[model samples]
Target: MERSTPISRRPKAVALTFDDGPDQIWTPRILDVLADYRIHATFMCVGKAVQRNPQMLRRIKDEGHIIGNHTWDHPNLTQLPLSDVQTQVLRTTEEIDRVAGVKTRLFRPPYGDLNDDIVRKVTSLDHEILLWDIDSWDWKGLTGPQVAKNILGHVRDGSIVLQHCAGPTETVKGTLEALPYIIEVLSESGFTFSTIPQLLHLSAYR
Candidate 1:
């Protein structure tokens, strides 16, 4: 299946987003890397994680990074009932608003799982569905160099690069290690990193 590129007016811009996180150890590390590069990215945080790490979410927002809902438990929305899908998305939305004091304007279904009904349900809740064009695949136990290669090899203008900060130790390790290299290489190539809302020209918070 062909994936659609995210909408962007600037040809040299790319939106970097992380999923399933706000993890105690990895999230902060990723934040540190972003801080070092002085770049901003989006984080699609799971509700349970947000509840567990409200301070991390606060830091993400405080640092000018956008946060999106990745659902409460990271379920495949396409297979779930519509009501269950609503619960998953809305619960996360509420949790984010509760912690960050801002309603999320973006949603990325777990595993990129979505269908017409799921889309409708999410939109009904006023979220723009977000997906990525470039996947780092850092969760596949790839080394940091390999993950960096995967991202840089596929990245293009207006790409949304998907990565994760939560998972097994190796997954987090590869992602963290590859981040600085990704930022440096892409910046040298004249690409500016952006948050999803910034790239899409949508509201980051409601």
Candidate 2:
């Protein structure tokens, strides 16, 4: 399936996004890899993870990547009350602001699970909801090469590719291993990596 973003109209552009991060160990490693390629990716961070490693959140910002809210915890917002859903989003947005001094306008629902209520609440808070068209499925115990294959197979111009920076040990390892090849192949194909805000031409922070 082809997914188009407003900014993706540029030829050969794609957004790379990592979910559930600011992890103490893996986040730094992922940053290093991105740095080596001179590319920036968006990180959708859990509020609890950001609180546990605020410095990592700052580092992500300092390094010129975008940080987005992934919720205070990894809850299925579609299953929660509207009030609880609001709390989940706002708390994380506040935590991100408290740590990085910027308010993010991007949100990715946990597990890509959402309903009308979750969308209404997130929209009311002035956030654009982001979901991926190309899933690397690194969380599924695939090898790095396999994950890379999956991503390359499905990606197109204006595609948002999903990978996890924090998860089980194997997931992190596979993502790390797959990233270089993913970058190399995509870059050689004339695809440039972009953050979500950059891709959508939206404000990264309020």
Candidate 3:
């Protein structure tokens, strides 16, 4: 009789991805909080930030977080030329590779916006496109309670959440303050945090 492979069992995991970062102020604080909770996240970084603070990029990689492409300048990708779109993704990926020694195959378009032209260029470069199922509106003027509520309200099995490392106004503080409670409630409800790659592995598209 042939022996069947024992399936590796894993929990229902959710992905938490941050965009427009490696910010000198907030990214480090967010990293510390994630480390304290022993959770991992995916950071979609801008190429210019990577170029300016290679060390922060290195720290992000070293801390076991997944890195992804978020373009050189945060813009509406649907409005940009194909060549410009290609340059944005490729340059960011290359910069991350140069500093972190890891070439990313994942990308999240800025503003969750993409057009056919952008799509063609992204696929041509062989990067997987990431879109969120849940947006916490941390980029807007939502309070910490609102942020936490938005996340907890929409979170579900295999849900991908959109948060940020750049807080929009002086009062927002990057929404890092909401993370602990979010993680706590989610974990209590039997949710496990995973990076985008891990989430993809469990997704039907994979």
Candidate 4:
């Protein structure tokens, strides 16, 4: 039985976002699934991950996926001093620029953890925070079916789904397994997949 929204004729859009990636293993596998589906997504990458896999970051850019700064070490920004927060964002944005020549303006905090100070710091760096409306809970180590159930149960027009490219081994596997089901069910229900920028109609790279 279908788990997504009831079929509608009107056009609707949702975003698929993967975080903490540009890794060798999980990232590529997730990219493969996206490529097979021919859908562009957003990758919110950790700074060190980009440095460790510069070429992977470039490939992600080349493949028409949007990239965002996810911080240097995936710290909770709300817990950091403003100086540290600024450094975290700047370091990652610079790394993305160094690798891909794309000035990404998207930022997503680790664990959806943020506060007013963090928000101000991010915007002061010329980035807009992008959060998800639906979370797959892949990072929590749910199975494929569980991840799929989490997303499909709540996705609707203009939903942004939080997923991950690199996490625990089981997490990535779960996300990978859930992709086909998520994509198919959404498509069947007339929900068009989009990168966050496209879904929000914002300039992706500055």
lDDT of 2 by residue, 73-182 (tens): 99988888999998998999999999999898899888888877788889999988888888888888899999999999987778898889888898889999999999
C-alpha root-mean-square deviation, candidate 1: 1.3
Evaluate model 2: give its lDDT.
0.88
How big is the RMSD of model 2?
2.0
> Candidates 1 and 2: which is better by TM-score?
1
| lDDT of each residue in 42-161, candidate 3, tens digit only | 998898988988899999888999888889988788888788888898888888888888888887888778777777789788887877778888877677788899889876677888
Runs of candidate 4 with Cα error greater than 4 angstroms are 1-11
lDDT values of the candidates? Answer: 0.88, 0.88, 0.79, 0.86
Order the candidates by lDDT, highest first — what do you get?
A: 2, 1, 4, 3
Worst 10-residue lDDT window for candidate 4 reads: 1-10
Q: Which stretches of candidate 3 lie over 4 Å from their true place?
A: 1-11, 167-174, 202-206
Please provide, for model 4 over 15-124, each residue's C-alpha lDDT reduced to its tens digit, 9 standing for 90 to 100: 89899997999999888888998999999999999999999998899999999999999997888899999999899989999999988898888888877888887899
Sort by TM-score, best first: what order? 1, 2, 4, 3
Q: How badly does each model clash, as a count of residue pairs?
A: 0, 0, 0, 0
Better of 1 and 4 by TM-score: 1
Find the 10 residues in a row with the least total lDDT in model 1: 1-10
Which prediction has more favorable lDDT, 3 or 4?
4
Q: Candidate 2 regions off by >4 Å?
A: 1-8
